[model samples]
Structures are given as C-alpha cells and as structure tokens.
Target: MKSNLVHKVVGSQYPLWRTVLLIIVLILGLGQTYVSTHFYLLYNKANSQHHDVHHEYYISVTKPINTVASMSNPNANGFTNAEIKNIQNQDFVDRVGAFNPTLFRIVIEPPKGMGHQDFRTLLFLESLPNAFLDVDTTNFKWKEGDKYVPAIIPRSYLDLYNFGFAQSQGMPQVTEGMIKLFVFNLEVKGPKGSHKLQGKVVGFSDRINTLLTPESFVNWGNETLGSVSKSELPEQLLLKLKNPLSSDIGSFFEENQYEISKSDGAKAALTNLINYSSFYVWLNGIIVCALSIIILLLVVYLSIASSKTEIMQLFFLGYGVGKIALPFQKIAAIKLLMAAFISLPIGAVVAGMIVKNSAQLVPFNSAGFQLQLLLVFGALVLLICALVVLLIKVRIKRLSV
Candidate 1:
C-alpha cells in the first residue's frame, strides 16, 4: 500500500536519538503544565474559602479614644448613622455589625470555695449577632424567663490570668473546662430594680476582645435593668470584607481616623505573604514548561532538515506534500498523547504527597484533581499537536519546492 511505502521512507529518515529526545521534551512540557495547574486550583480554592475563618476577613473598627473628652459625652466616640452608611456603601465591605454594649451595671460574684471569696468587680458585656460569632451558638441563646445566662469570654483573658496573674500570685492555673464549670451570680443594678441571675462561661473567642453574651440577653437587660436611655450608639463596629488585601481598607480607615487592632493587622500581613509565595511557584512552573516547548520545537526542526533531500525526491515522484508530512505529524501527535496520558497518575501522586505533607501548616483540598487536570492538559496537548503538524507541513512544502 502507499501508506506502507511512506511509513518505511519516514521511519528510515528519523534517527533513534532524535526520536527519543522528542518524546522526553513532550513529557517534560506536559507534566509541568499539569502540576502547575493543579496547585493553582488548590490555592485558589483555599483563598476563596478563607473568608469563612473568623480572624481572617472580619475586623473590629473603632474611633481613636480621647479619655478626658469622652467622660462627658460617650457618644462622641461612637459612629453616627451617616458614618455607618458610608462604610456600608464602600466596595470592600461585605456586611457590618455593631457591638451593642449593656447599658446597666453588673457585678460578678464567683462561686464559693474557689479561693477568691472577696473578688467582685464591675463587668461590662457586649453582644453581636450570632452570625458574626466564631463559636457554636446552639447554647448561646437566651429567653426572658431563663434564669441562667451563658457567656463567651476572650481567650486572651484566660491567658492573662494563667500566665500573668496565676504565676505572679502563686495560684493554680485553670483550664477552659474548669472555668465553664464555675457558676457565678450576676447582680444587675439599674434605676428600674436590682435582679440576681446565674451565669456561666460557655466558650472563648480569639477574635472579639470583650466578654460576649447573646444579643437577646443584652436587649432584654437594657430594657428591664438599664437606667440609661435607649438612644446610646455603639462605640465599635465589626466589618466583614470581600477582599482583605484591598487598598480601600487602609485608605478608608485612615481618612476616617479609625483604628484596627494589632491582631487584625498581623492577619492581613500573613495573608499577603502566602499570596506572594503562591504566585512565585506558579511563575516558576510556567518558565519550565516554556523551556521544554522550545526544546521540542528544535528537535522537530532538525528532524525535518535532515530529511529535506528525501522529501524533494518524493515530491518529484508524484507524491503530495501532505502525504510526505503525514508520518512526521503522526509521530508528534502520538508522543503528545502519550505525555498527556502518563502525566495524570504522576500528577495525582505528587499532589497527594504535597497535601499530606502540608496538612498541618495549610489545608489543601484536592477535590477535583483528575477532572480539572484532564480538561486543562487535554486542551494544551491538542494545541501543541496542531502547531507541530502545521510546522511539519510548511517545512516539507518549502523543501519540496
């Protein structure tokens, strides 16, 4: 058959070394492309899901405090309705919640026999919506008739007591479980009347600073026990952001003379560090793939140049340029297909290894690994094969002429 004669001619023209070199470069380019794409998707998913974490995208905003000036009018440090509206309209903000502080006075009396028999101090409680809280809120709700109140205190409070107070006073350090077991009496005093309620610590938070109770509790306390008018505005605001790295955050806060805590700033800095590192990894993989592509093209050119004389003879014998180029085109297509197929298992194994090793430091989800890898690399191999086939046809046509 005509095909058999063409194959014999083409097979003799390509040397063993050149064929081997071509296969190696194709594998190199395709494998690099697959691996890089896999990690890019992995980190991109991580970036999108990070907002769900408490300390990453949510930050508390407050005006700068002037203690002497705030004594007469505490509302001076609070945000006006206009200011709140402006922040809500900004492109970076997703949602905003205010910290509603209790308007009444409260004194906490610890359970007896805990070695602090005479410890009683005025305590302040603030409430935010349950959606903003990081802890489980099933047990955090309160009704008007409930005798017991559940509270969430800051983790830093316990750390300060254990590391600083306990160590300094030579007292025993208490754990979270122990704190939750201790019941206290909350003596709420106001112009209306004085009421005693039982309270207990239910959870701890690292994001919010003050002691927190259910929003329902705070509203009920302000209505029943608080002496102050209900017109008091909130002094602090919590903002959920769409993108924490947006320039609008710093500019808007600076222009309004608002301040964010040190912990929020640290979280933003850490996020920036991670984003930059991922970008560099993706760039390096791109460079390697590009270099491999160039090497593969060089081998193709050399193979055609060596067979130029035979191609011219075949053209003079009435064979078409298309027929003469078919064998070389088939070689490129088969090798590219081989590379694409082989890289799948290899890439999955490498990605699995990476996810396993970094599980503790970073959570990497490899959920759609095979499907995405297949679609991305399938298109890449097809594009490269079409390019290589076109290159062979053009070079052979020129040689035959």
Candidate 2:
C-alpha cells in the first residue's frame, strides 16, 4: 500500500511531462557518451593514418668530421676526426657548410636478432628518411660474406636540406633547417641474415642531427663507412628548433638524382595524423556543447508548458513550486557537466592510443601514457565545472514562480 502511494505521488508530482524530460536527459547523457567515444575512435584512426603517411621515408645527416672550438678555453679548442670529416669550410659548396643541403645521409647498423628484410619493414613503417645506407661488403669479400649494400638518396634529398649556412662556418641552422631531409633505404646482413631498412630525418639541430630508424646501433663496427657506432652518436642531436619553417617545404634534392625505395600506402599515411585529430576533437566539442544547450532549452520549455496543472496543484498543497523546480535546473546543469566530462577523457584516451600506437607503428618517440591520461582527466574536470556553472545560470532564469 505504501509502495502504491509512493508511485502515485511520483506519477502525479512528475506527471508524464516531467518524466519524459528526465528520460530525454538520460538519453542525451548516453548519447554524449556515444558521441565522445566514437569521436575519439575516429580521431585515433585518422591520427594513425596521418602518421603512416609521413613516415614513408627515413633520413639523417652525418658530420664526417668533428670540430670543437672552445671560446672560453683555448687549450680545449681543436678539430677532432669527426670535425674534419663533417665540417667542410666554404671551399666545398656542396658540403655541410655550403648552400645548406637539406638532404644528407643516414646510415643504419642493424642489431644481431634483426635481419635486413625485417629491418627494412621496420624502416618503411618508420617513414624512411631522405638518406642513404653504406652497406659494408668488405667482410663478404674478405671472409666470403655478403657484399656492402648501397642505398643512395638522389640529389633531390639535397634540395630539401634547408639548414642555411652560418655566414662564417656555412653550417645549416635549425632556424633555417631544411623542411624535409633525405630518406635512406638500405639493406644489411646481421649475424642472423640480411635485412632491409629505412629511416627519416625527423629532427636536426646545430651540427648534430637525428634519424628515426628501426635499426639500432648495437653490434656496430669501427668502420665509418656503413654506419656510425652508437657511442659516436650524440645524446640529443635532433632537438626541436625554436624557429621552424611555416611553409610546406618541398624536397630539396632533384627527383632523378637518387633512387629511393618505394613507399607503401601505410607508410605514407602518418604525415598529418596528430594534427587532424586535434582539430577534430576541438570541433566535435564545440558542436556537441551547442547541441546540448539547445536540447536542454527545448526540454525545459516543454516541461514548463505541459505540466502547469500538476505544478499548480503542488503549490496549493503547501509545496514550494520554486524549490521543486530546482531539480529541473539541477538536471540541466548535470547534463551539460556530464557531457563535458565524458568528452575530455574520451578524446584524451583516443589521442594517447593514437600517439602510443604511432611510436610502435613508426619510429617517433611519443610521450608516456600517464601524461596523456593526466592531461585528459584534467581537461574533463575543468570542462565539467565550467559547463555546470553556465547551465545553472541559464536554467535558473527559466524557473517559473
């Protein structure tokens, strides 16, 4: 009997009109979840595709010589063997100090377990850079082993080398670095067997440069011909430049000058992956928020218009109609808050997955999952708070006396 009375009170107090509003709110909340999840999924898919596109070619630059000039200490100033090989004076117009050849060589030394073929797959997926590989076949001739595999990037890669010469040293600067670098597609024979590989010039700063490749520098030899030893490589050669080019810089090298390993469709998809997903996330948020507001307003208007009799009776029964109306305002605020909360995590998870998969699928280094999670969670909380406040202000004004 008590249950029936409770039901009757609920039915008459809310009526079909208010009940329908509650149902609509629930649907909208769920719909927000669905949209947020799918948006993230779609964003991840798009980001992955873009990353694939940009990673087709791998590249790197080497300073065959190392020259360290100490301004503070004269005794420490001297040219190392690396300086002699890499830093050319103004004499060699085609060298590093010359007209800023954006295109350079990126040599790879594969590890023991990895073969040339496997390495190549990894390289291709990494979006091979505009560099070449010097396969040392000297052992093959000397010990009846394989010959040195030669992969030469065309002069076109050179054209892409944009580091402008320092008027004095003629070395390229990251501020004026080439928009694109060389892609070196080469094959090597590890202890196990032969493997194909590629790398890209994802970063370059100062005289030092960095290449993203599947091939590790472990088990490398002293011969500077094929690949540089891991110790020889700097810790941070490919640091981000403060001044990057704004334009869509094209390849620096000429097309016919060098032959690059063919790029697969998957390799070419990474070009604009992250950028596009970011844009989409922002756009989706804007659209969803706008739609939520409109839906809330419509629901409130209908609830007020249709439930006049029920509301009046409640007022007569010693109930403060305004207080009862407070729930409607609360529901609207909750709807907006929940939708915003849902969207942020969904977008962040999608971004993190995309970035993580990107590092695995390609050769780039993505931030940790924890960082992405924190960022996403923070964004969601902030958005929820902001939306709740806005909804409260809007809904409170519509409450009838």
Candidate 3:
C-alpha cells in the first residue's frame, strides 16, 4: 500500500509554475556570475599586456633642480626616511627601495693599455638591497684578495658614454652586449687603502640612473675603505609605484614639491586606471552571486515540498531521509550543472567581443579566456550542487515523522 502511494505521489508532482519560476531565477543567477567574472578578467588581461611591454621599466623620484633642502642635512638633496615612509603608505606606489651612497671620494684604476688617462675620475658607487635587483646575482661573490664586484649601470648612462663621450674622444660606440662580453679590471683608492677590484657590467637599470652595487658588497666595502666624512643616509631614492598615472598621485607629488620621471612614459598610469575600473565589475558580480544563492534555496524548497506526500509515505515505509531526498537533490544538481555550462561560454564570448573591440588599446591573444577561469567555473558548479543537496537532505529530515 505504502510503496504504490510513494510512487504515485512522486510521479504526480507537476509544479509547472514552480519549475518556470526557478528556471528564470537560475538564468538570472548564472548571468550575474558571468558578468562579474568577465569584467574582472578584462582588467587582468589589460594589466598583463602592460607588464609584457614594460617589464624592464620603472619610474624614479627626483628632487627639484636648484631647490634647497627644507631641512639642514647633508643628504637634503634627496628625500629623507620620514618622507619616504609616508610615500610608501600610498596606494599608487607599488615598490620602494634606496641606494646607499658613499661618503668619501673614489679614484678608479682602469686596466692597463685598455684605458686612456681617466684614472683619477671621482666615481660614485651606490648600493641597493639584493631584493630590488632584476638580474642574476649568483656570481656577485666578494671575498678578500679576490674582489669581483658585479655591477649594474643605468642604460642611459651607457648611451651617453657611447654617443656623447665616445664621439668627442673619437672612440668607437660600444653596444650593450659588447660591454658584458669583456672582463675588466679596476683599482679603487680610498683614504684607508687602495684595493684591486674586478668589474663586470652584469645588467642595466631603466629606473634608477646610478651605478648600483650589491648591498652586501657595499656594507663590506664601506666598513673597509669608507671615509668618516659622511653618514649612511641615501641621497637619491627609486620608487616603484602601483599607479603612476593616478591624478591623486600626481597631485600628491606636486603638493610635496617632488619631481617624477617615468621610464615607461604614461603606460603604468593607464594600467592602474583599468585595474580600478575592473574591480567595480567584480563587486557587482558578488552582489549577483548573493542574490542567485537565495533564489536557489527557495527553488529547492518548493521542488521538494511539492513532492512532500510521496517523501513522507516512503519514510513510513522505512525509507531513509537521504533516499527520500535523492530525487530532489538530483533535480537541483542537474539545474546547477546546466546553468554553469551555459553561463561560461556566454561569458567568454562577451569577454572576447570586448577584447576584440579594444585590440588597438590592449593587445591580447586571439584566444579569449584563460584556463584558470574554467577551473574556477568548475569549482563554482560543484559548490552549488553540494549546497543544494545538503538543503534537500535537511528539509527531508525535518519533514519526517
């Protein structure tokens, strides 16, 4: 008697109105997820494009020419630690590091026969922390009697030397590759003593316009041959900004009376703007997801309740709550799977269209979306299915006896 009633009750459920309503709700929920994900993905793609083109570039901080120091310190020409601390707290600034300037004079002894008479040149050697270096410092080992000082020079400095200095002196213009090809020797004479050092042009900086040495080598060299005339404060600083193009950033520097020079022209600023805008799309997507989940809960409840008589009959016939909930769980799972499958391609197509329209502005591959998005979509589908199944089980347990 109970088995026939259970089958009849289960088979009799034809809640056409509830089905129609839930189908509409599912479409809206899926649409929300797609819109949110697509917007954020566009921003990600744009930012990636900027990085690929300007990977070797950065912006620099400078003091106004002929501007006297606000405070009376020897390193007044550059920013002080207090000012730097404030700058680091800003959202527009991405990275910040400094160069340690030598307090005393440096006289270099170039290799014999290769150098023409510029040995007494007062050279300035600055040290930046190892973290900021982009090149491989694996061979930058400095030891007693074997001082092989790996060096990084500004590309502009090399260009000036090759074009202006070499032209005036009637020397051949040397390419960047050629400088790294040769091993060179140098002698540095300080107030304490003179030491022989090997110099190799390992890399170039597009951001900082200074001769850079590893921080380890600088700490050791300063202790050994440094003069007592100067302190440890840096004269110039290099800034890595997150959004150099922001109006607030530009205004902040101008108000502080600081100078800004960018190696990547105006590209960094534009990329930051796109990031900010895309973030809003992500937030809207979140709102849509919240609404969709609510709708899903209501839809699951109605579907299960419509078949309540059959479910209760099964329970009285010694059916487990899990078994009674299984059919409703299956329905919810199927709907969720359908929603995800339909939403993902639609989102991808929309994103591709946008990318296509913006091809001139932000160049991307012809393939529209990233594989990571597909993984995230799969996770979303599973999560929704699991939640709906749990919802059905809970309702089944509550309704029994």
Candidate 3 per-residue C-alpha lDDT over 276-303 given as tens digits, one digit per residue, 9 for 90 to 100: 6678777777677667767877777765
lDDT of 3: 0.68
Each candidate: RMSD: 5.0, 17.1, 7.0
What's the count of clashing pairs in each model shown? Answer: 0, 77, 4
Over the stretch 166-206, how does candidate 2's per-residue lDDT look in tens digits? Answer: 33345443331232233345554433345454433333222
TM-score of each: 0.74, 0.33, 0.61
- Once model 1 is optimally superposed onto the true structure by TM-score, how far is the C-alpha of residue 267 displaced, in angstroms? 1.4
What clash count does candidate 1 reach? 0
Global lDDT of each candidate: 0.79, 0.38, 0.68
Q: TM-score ranking from best to worst?
A: 1, 3, 2
Q: After superposition, how far is residue 100 of candidate 2 from its true place, in Å?
A: 5.7
Q: Pick by TM-score: which candidate is best?
A: 1
Task: Give the per-residue lDDT of model 1 (tens digit) for 1-401.
Answer: 88778877765766788767766776676677777777776777766755444235777888899877687676878889899989999998888889988999889988777767899989989999887787777789899878689999999999999999999999999999999888898988887877889898989886788899998988888888765544388889998777777877888899989997757765855676677667777777767766776676677667777777777778889999899989877876787688667766776677678766655566656577567767767776787778878987887888876
| Candidate 1: residue 193 Cα off by (Å) | 1.8
Let me know the TM-score candidate 1 reaches against the reference structure: 0.74
Question: Where in model 3 is the C-alpha error above 4 Å?
Answer: 1-21, 31-75, 78-97, 102-124, 141-149, 155-177, 183-198, 206-209, 214-233, 238-287, 304-320, 354-375
Deviation in Å, model 2, residue 321 alpha carbon: 10
Worst 10 residues of 2 by lDDT: 235-244
